[model samples]
Target: MPDAASNDYSMLRDAVVFLLAAIVVVPLFRHFRVNSIVGYIVAGIVIGPHGLALIRDVEGTHRLAEFGIVFMLFTIGLELSFERLKTMARYVFGLGLAQVVVTGAVLASGALIFGAGWGQAAVIGGALALSSTAFVLQLLSERGELSSHFGRVVLSVLLLQDLAVVPGLAVVTALGSEPEALAWALIVAGLKAIAALGLLLAVGRLVLRPLYRMIAETRSPELFAAATLLVVLATAWGTAAAGLSMALGAFLAGLMLAGTEYRHQIEADIRPARGLLLGLFFMSIGMLLDLATIIPQLPAIIAAVALLISSKALIAAALGWCFRLPLPVAVNAGLHLAQGGEFAFVLFSLAMGAAVLPMEMGQFLLAVVAISMTLTPLLALAGRKVQARLEQRAAGGLEALMTETEGYSDHVVIAGFGRVGRTVAQMLDARDVQWIAIDLDAKNIAQARSRGLQVFFGDAAQDAITAAAGLDRARAAVITLDNPAAAASALRNIKKKLPDIPVIVRARDASNMGELMRGGATSVMPETIESSLLLGGAVLRSLGQAESEIDEVIEFFRRDAVEGGQRAADDEQ
Candidate 1:
């Protein structure tokens, strides 16, 4: 009984320490525009056993933190549907397959040259050949580049790497088995994995939508959230039970729900939990680093880290270029994915436990991987700078060529394609007005493209996406993003990029209209005011008033609303 109480107390203390570390470290890192992931890792190191010893239960912490990855994968799945995946099939299978194979072979050869046996070399190569999906995705999302052409290629590669984990683990298991039984072990693992995948797909397609619909009909937010959690955990457990990664299961569950109407709500509900747990996951990784052991071999570790990053980066870039990606985009993707991934730790740990790899070598490799991960944000920043330079130097290069092929000129660029934006687009279409739309919702983009609308999937706040949309050649721009903060940000970005271009923005209410105008919107239409005016017009018409009189009354109210918003802006100024 006493031991149980002590364990509970220890867990509570550790949680407090973790939160404190994040509270202090994350904001500091964000203030400098650094990736919050780096901050989380640094926080982990500070409070970990190697640092202040604020948390001694490393394994327990790791178990809890792993859900972060599961949740992250689920959210990523929500962003993609089967149709989009089918479209990306070539990159996923071709570029992704080539990347893993070539990168693994090169690393394995190097390992062999360094005196490691075939089994150990294979493990090392397979593990290091993959890149950290969590780190790369978070970075891309932060920079608003996840929907860019470069980001799409990178995401395709990451998806393949996630799938490759099953085979990688199978190889590790086979290596641990007796010589005569190795082939059998691999075959069994493969069959089990396929069966698990098939079961997940079958169950998800049939069960998830109905489950969500039933829960949503209750109009209970709590029940809906609980249902979301259940689906994520159940699917994750299913895959892990079959000797597959839990994250993969969660991703599959999300993919199933991607086509459903509840996707956006589920994503919103899971976001907070995902961020918190994912940060904890990074902290757990930091706890794994033993500075005392690493200091003695600092120089060698640094050398290995450099080699691992450089080799992976160059190999990825070469393959991407060969696969017909532009030099800049390919190089950027390579640098973003150059670091050793989280799976490396899993593979190395398994190998060490199975007595297939020496503890000393595994520890050394883990340290190298950790250091490389810590350097990823910096590496990605370097890639962006390099890409900018290359793009500048090649003015009429691939980017310009692609833009020319799209043939955008004197068109209205719509920053959002929600209901309001769609209505505006339709009205423009009726008059044959040339226009293009950009949105972050992959599902929405897929549906729009199917109907032959010139809508693209990307963040309008990103200069690269805006440039690709031919913002320079656009006669006007419209900002109708549903989120107020997102709408304001889009307005500011457009005004900054092209101050001379007329920009129309939609506001949620009159209170938001002044803020949008202050952000340099040429005109702001508050939805609430417009709806109220229309309703008032209807009421007057029902009272048998003349149609002309009702129109005049509504116009008077509209002018008053605009004047009121302008007055508010003037008062604030």
Candidate 2:
């Protein structure tokens, strides 16, 4: 056996090498707009035992790297609330369930046609049916597409795939065991999963808030960070011990904390760790690529990858259509989910270990999965092209409306249809003024239209949407995007097109007020200032102050807020 000192030194060296490679490669790829995932994986290939042999203990590195996925799932959970999940339940459960059933059945039949036993074929089919949630979600997020219709559909299917891991594991475990025992194994697994989830939900409901409250009361950043990790790992462990996947446990823990006041703080603390660890995870996946075996089987590998992408894409698209998604959205979602997922590694490894899959077949399938993951970014690009073409075709039918702004002269254009924008539009309507609104949310547009409001479904910041909304002839534009960056972006886009038009933009706080003003907003109303002024007025009224006195005080403060920006401008001059 190696000396302890030598082993420790070797481990340190390998870690240093991996970090160095990531630091160099990830940014280089990102600078060119490539997914950092691809960069990290390529770095692993160059430094791993299979390539330059710079890192000899690939397995050890990979084990450590798995934590990245855990961190990612935790963060993903933090973003999701029960309400959000409830809204997407039909797609998440109905469509997600269908994708797995249909994709697996078809792929399994294909495997059977290739002469594999039903048991082995089933394993292969189930494994391939799962797509890389981590890869697709991260890719969409990097592109700022997660809130888009396509992104939500992709998420629903990926979420179901993650949930399906439990039963998939059970099926693999029961495959080579007694045939009658299969039912018992599934029953036991299902009960354990329910018990684990129930316990988590109960604890989360009763204890998580108070637990965080106590930790927050300490007012120690170090303690808070540690407590966050503890919660994530503990829940992950509990679920794993309960025979469910660790990611599921982490996700549940996140969901529990999501509605808490400290959700954003928890997310902020976990992000750095998630990014680094996820990079490590991606690198480890690259290290697993067996080029020696795969190169000789290139033709077959290519065929398998093509078949998998095509079949899964078709299946997902069909499901999307059934769910009533637009053709482009449904097709894009299908492409996003076409690649095989990280769970396939777990599923295949278990199946091989249980002797349900032959050694040769298992190795080949692993290569197939790895190659498919590598092709996902490329497939995503293709999906974008397809979406663009469909969008162009749709635009052809609206060319006259898209270009004609003559009838919209002096009409107010609201850039969002959320509460703030809705309030502004209602006031305009009350005055009998003409107005049109555009919002990114389709549901919001539909709801507003149902209420007899003139709201269009499109991104306000997009030049096309703004033009379609008749920005060139509008009396003024109101920007009320909740996201500060989006608000600033819409303001700038409006100014670029109609440089002299009055644009009133909302700011989240005083800090963003100047930024929005500089972004060419005619006036920036910070929500903080407005709320404080309103509160002051309400308090004075409650204290029985005369209405005139309250009005006088409010008017003075409002004048000061507006002049504060002018004073800064004068100072700059």
Candidate 3:
């Protein structure tokens, strides 16, 4: 047995090797416009036992790298809200479910044709069907495209796959010696896992917000980080207890926290952890590639990688097109998700452990997954360029609104074309006001345009849409969105980019008044307060009150409104 001192030295040596490789190779790769992921993987292969033999403990390194994925999921959850997730449910459940089922079935059929047993083929199919949530999401986050249409769909599909992978793991574990008995066991376990998830979400909804709020009040970064870590571990444990994966639990915990107020701070605290860990995770995967085992099978490995990337990409693209995404967006999303993912490592290990897959087959599949992942960033970059070209070609009709706004000055930019927006536009039009309006609701724009309003179909909060509305020369902006979240986002976007332009916003209640003002609204009109004041003024006039008395009452209410707004704003500060 090795002494403690010797073991410590070994660990230190391993760390130095890993860190030195990353430091040297990553910058070089980045200088060539290659993704840091490729660099990390390349570094791993070089310093790994298969190459220079500078580092040992590959399995232990892989285990440590998993925390990177956990922290990454946690941060991803912080960026998403339950409301936002709900909006993507169709894509998550529909497209995601279809992708797995169809891809798995087809791949399994192919595997069987290649002389594998049905059970083993099933395991391979399930494993290869999953795309890398970590790799794709990290890329999207780096590119700042997570909020784009293609990114949202890819995220939804990945989330569903994370959940879907649970059963695949179970299936792999069960398919070994007693296929029938364990298959039934997996079914029961899957049901229990679903129940556990439901229970977690229910309980999290009840207490997560309040719990984080309490943590926030303490105002201690250490305490808050501790709490976040606790939540992540507890959630992971809960799912593990139900025979589900810890990563799934971490993701759910993130989803719960996404609905809370402390999300941004939580994200900030965990970002560094996610980055380092993710780098380690990628490097560990690269280390798994044994050139000795792979070189003789080079032709076969290349064939498998090409087949996997092409089949998966085609499936993803076809699904996106079926979902009615724009041609470029569909193609881009498909290309982004073409590669095999991290989950393949888990599935392969489990299959090998259970003696379902022969060692040689498992190694080959592992190489395929690793190589595909290494190639993904380059493919995504090419896809992005192709998408840009397609978008440019398709830009003719899409540019109509921007063209209409060109060379115009002193025009009001109306952000919503709803009831209130229509009223405001009508009033402005009566005075010959030149204005351009953008709304996400196409039907609303169509209706308004039929009635001769200058309305267009586009999200006002989108930078492209706003710029097209002539923000540089706009006289002012009027926001009349009924959705408080959307209104707040639009308010911030406009204020941040066009601070010199004055803005008037319509608010549903006083609850949001302070936030709206803080977000840089020049004026916030509460619908209830304005309507009540209008009614009260009309009633006093009908009561035959003196004109001077009516004027005084109106003036008093207006002054009170201003004071109330000011107080709300101050309290927010």
Candidate 4:
């Protein structure tokens, strides 16, 4: 066995090698039109087990990578507050449910083809169903898609996966050498996990926010960091005590703190730690790229990548379609989600430890998962290209909306150009109303403009964004990102800065309506009410109620607006 002093020395040496390789190789990937993530993986191989064999602290390195995931979850939790999740109910619930069912089914079938037992197949399928939250979120963020319709769908599906992965981890853990007892343990563990999540949400709403506010008031970054760390550690400990993964507990802790005031600051402070650990993680994975193993396993590994991507992509596409997304969106979400991910390694490890899978299968799974991780970004780039091409072909019809409407000042401003909001803008347009559309969704802005509409790209929640959208010059502002929490926050900011700006906010359902009203929205409306009304109006017109009836209703609403009655805004968000 290696001496303790020698082990420490070797670990330090590996760190230098990993950093040096990352610095040199990252640039090369950019030059070659490859993703930075791909570069990191390649660099991992070069300085890891495959090339120089310079990294020796394999276990220690991965433990650090684990922190990369922890910080990452904290950031995700901060971003995805309950209010944000509310508006994304359709995608989160609809698309998310579909992705889990469909993808899990497909992967399980493939495992069955390999003659695995039902329990093993369940483990494989469920594990395969989880896309890499870390990788996909980072990619979309860099490409700026975390807020688009498709991005919303991806986000929803990812959230579901996060919730689902906990059970998956339990499932793998339960299938120990004594399968029957393990199965019962797994069932008990899952129930406990669900209870923990409920407790997290409850405690967060009741206690975490106040605690964080108290910390924030002190203006101590160190104290804030310590509190965050405490939350994660405590929650993680609680979860393990109940027989779940510590990661799951950490994630719940993040979810609890998501509603806190210091979420953004906490994320900022912890990000540096995440960044460093992420590098070390990639380095550790690189060490696994042993040339000796890979050379013999290349064919099988490449085949696994193809199989995993193709299979998972098809399942994801079906789920997207089931969620009623546009065809292009469905296809792209599928492709983007096709890869095997880091969790595959986790599941495989558990499987190996339990002797459910041979050591050979675990090694093979590692190689295949690594390859799929490398391909994920490439798949995303491909999806972007495909989406662009589809948009270009569809641009002819979009041009009609871009015909340059003049006299936009002192008019209404719509912040998001998504389909629902765009429809509202169009209805107002047919009446020759003056309004300028603002959106952070570049795709939506581009599409809107291609059709002859006057839409600008912007984040309307920011003072800078509203200023760019001519908020002060505009008579009214419509908050329409479909995210209730963000919408409420934006409404608050607008009220503070320009108290007289009449703001109409949208909601997914009644539960969201009150929050916006409390936040100072002039009116709040749900999608269903408006859609039903439009259909009712068309039927009335067909029955010969006369165009005057529609005109009269509009006039009445305008009159009601003076006294602030129930005219309900568009709920497109």
Candidate 5:
């Protein structure tokens, strides 16, 4: 009854409160320079239960939140590529593993200190160990840091947290009533994961790519989309049905698709779904915060939240320094990743289901995750400022290195100039970076110099071209390349000879998450799309947005792509 009857009129009810939050707090947060997510959560709390009791039926709201998570995972899957994962193996395995072990250890200790037994304490710790991937990544993408060094490390660790949600959930579930069963269930889960992975690896190498290519050759986008969905959904279902979590299934599907030739296409298709659902996911968090219950505990809870964030940064910084990254880089990376994410929600849910944690405790933890996630944008921005300052201070010593690569006499080193670069040179009047662009086409190079922009035109992937580009001491290498592989390879080569030189590379895709961590990619911006989308959404939402229609439109587009039919009806135009 709570799930069905309550949901029936939920939409009508939600419309008003959601709007109230948007109309009031959204502008307030913007006006005060607070992160918008923080405003949204605060709004949810104000109109949520225990406040105005605007969302009287909590069950219905939770149901919609579930869809938010699903969409969130789907989008996370879209942003990943196999090669990209392999490139940041350090962050994936090392950073991720360390995060799980350390964060869990710390939380488990806290629970024990709070008077819980080992089993109970461990479950509590497990819940606390998780963070909000949806909030963290959304904020990161918004800041255009997905391809930055900080973003890569943070994402690697977060991805680990997401994957860890499976067993952690199982542990919480097992510990609730039958604590003794926890150990056995984990062993079973581990074995199942291995077998599933093996089966996927074999099938992936033999079947997936060719099948997708065959599907693509038919020029049937719907079939391609259907096949893509089938791969992920079926695998996710199989993993969950096999005594694992749905998160594992999704991650495995992404891993399996990593090596495929059609990886980009699959990523592109899934991206829009990821974007929209992601916002809803955050909104769902806003719905969950029972501010009244939390108000009295605000002081202690705020301290805990601050501790949770600060400690993680220290942990990350220590790890980065140990890895021999620049002190500035290490610190920035640490600060950028200081918060907890959505995976924490799963742990709490599992624990509640297992009865290891009381419902109130889980609710409290949700409040914590929501608060932390909402604060992420502001935190990241501040940390970025600190990082920029640190970089500037360090750059004073690196100036000679920069000058060496930028071009001593006359040269052109072009990173992605596009429209912006074209105009930059016209104002220069024969001034050049003493390096040419590493473009795929000669027409681009011709256009650059036709406007009298210093230009060299060739793929940076070639050793001959890098050599020709005067890469040895080209003053500064303006790596304006778009593709990840090309950009990364170019950076590696630049670092080979001019190891200390400053090089800037353009990062234009969210999927190119690892580009910022490459050897010589001093700056990174994975995509400008998210900001544009955010602006668009704000405009739409402000002009009396209708959730039902938005949902219908999104579902239509997704289903069209999913079913491989009616490929954009207006496409005939």
Candidate 6:
């Protein structure tokens, strides 16, 4: 009984330490415009056994930290449906396969030249061939580039790498088997994986939507959240039971729910948990770095890190180029995927346990991978800078502008191609007005382009994107970005560039209308106010109020609301 109490107290203390480290470190990194992921890692290094020794249970911490990857993959799956996956088949299968194969072969050859045996070289090459999915995805999301062309390309490669983990593990296991049994072991592993995936997909498709619908019908937020957690954990457990990675199962679970109506709610419910756990995962990665061991071999480790990053980056870029991606985009994708991935740790651990990798060599490789991951944000920043330079130098020499806005004078410029912007475009289309739209969603842009619409992919709040969209030649501009901050930014940018241009902005609620108007919007349409007015008018009509009277009442209310908002804006100014 005493031991049990002590155990509970120890766990509580560790949790507090973890939270304190994150609270202290994350904000400092954010202050300098650095990615918060770097901060989490730094925090782990500081509080970990190697540093202050506040948290000495590295293995136990790692077990909890892995849920972060599971949740991250689940959220990523929620964003992508099977249809979207099908569309990305070329990159996922072709370029992704080529990347893993070519990169693995080159690195393996290098490993062999360095006096490593075939089994060890194969393990080293395969492990380092993959890039950090969590780091890359989180960083891309932070920079708002996950929907960019290169971002999609990066995602495609990462997806394939995730899928490759099963096979990589199978190979690791095979190495420890007798030569005659090795082939059989791999075949069995592959079959088990396929069966697990098939079962999960079949069950998820038939059950997840109904389960969510039933939960949602209860109208209990807590119940709905509990159901989401259940689905994620159950799916992860099922896959792990079948000798597959838990993260893959979580992703599959998310993919199953992606096409359902409850996807957004599920995403919202899971986001906080995902962020917290994912940060812990990064911290765990940091905890793996032993400062004492690294300091003794710093120069050699640095060389290995450089070699690994450069080789992977060059291979990824060359493959992207061969797959018809632009040089700049290909290079950017390469840099984004240059680092050794989380799976490398898993594979190395397996190899070390199976006696395929020497302990000394494994520790060195682990240190190299961990350090490379820490440098990812810096590398990504460098990649963006390089891409910008390349694009600027060859701006006119590339393919025709994504949107043909050169001859579109006196056209309407829709800043966001979402539901509200789409409706506005449809109204303009009825009048035969030539208009173009700018949006950040790659999927939305693709669908619009397929229908022969002049919708281009870009951030509406950016000066360059707006200029390219011919905002100066626009007769009017509409800011319909769903995010309040984004809408305000677009309004301000448009007013700054073409001060006299009439800009209409969409606000999520009346609370945002005044700020948007003050930011130079000629008109602000608040969805909440409009929705309430419509509902009120309906109620009045149901009570037998005259149509003309109801209309007048609504008009009066709308006018009063706008005037009230303007006065509020004036008072604030």
Question: Which of the numbered candidates is closest to the native, going by highest lDDT?
Answer: 6
Q: List model 3 lDDT by residue over 1-573, tens digit each.
A: 479889999999999888788889999999998889989998889988899988889889998888888887777777777888888999999999988888888889889999999888999899999998888988888865676557788999998888887788778777876757676877788798879999999999888888888888988899999888898888878987887767778888998887667887888778777888899988998889999988999999999999998899888889888988777778888898889999989999889998999998999999999889998887798777666556544432237678879987999999888899989988998999899888754446557767776777656677887888887789999999987888988888888889978999999977788888878788888898888877888898999988789879877986787668778888868
Q: Please write out the lDDT profile of model 2 over residues 98-208, one tens digit for every residue.
A: 999999999999999999999999899999999997788788767666665567778888888888888899999999798888899889999999999999889878988
Query: Against the true structure, candidate 5 has what lDDT?
Result: 0.64
RMSD of 1: 6.7
In order, the Cα lDDT scores of the candidates are: 0.87, 0.84, 0.84, 0.72, 0.64, 0.88
TM-score of model number 6:
0.81
In model 4, what lDDT does residue 299 have? Answer: 89
Question: 300-328, model 4: which lDDT tens digit per residue?
Answer: 77887898898888778876777666666
Model 6 lDDT tens row, 218-272: 9999999999999999999999888888988998899889898999999999999
Q: Worst ten-residue run, lDDT, model 6?
A: 394-403
Write the number of the candidate with greater TM-score, choosing between 3 and 4: 3
For candidate 3, the lDDT comes to 0.84
Off by over 4 Å in 5: 1-36, 39-43, 50-80, 204-207, 258-265, 358-362, 397-573
TM-score of each: 0.79, 0.87, 0.72, 0.69, 0.65, 0.81
lDDT against true structure, model 4: 0.72
> Is 3 or 6 the stronger prediction by TM-score?
6
Clashes of each: 0, 1, 0, 15, 30, 0
How far does residue 567 in candidate 6 sit from its true spot (Å)? 10
| Candidate 1 clash pair list | none
Better candidate by lDDT, 2 or 4: 2
Residue-by-residue lDDT tens digits, candidate 5, 1-573:
888876667777776666666678878888988777777667766676656777666666655555445544544554666677687788778867876788778878877887777876786666666666666766776655566556677778777776676687667667765757878878877787678767766776677778887898999888998887787667666766766555556666666666567777888877665554444455567767766767888987798788777877777777777776666667776766677666676666766776777877677676676677777776777766665456534432123224334544345466445554554345444552343454433335446557654454444655655665566655566665655666677778777767777776655644353434435455544445434455656676778889666556555643443233222222332
Give the CA lDDT, 0 to 100, for residue 231 in model 6: 95
Query: Which model scores highest in TM-score?
Result: 2
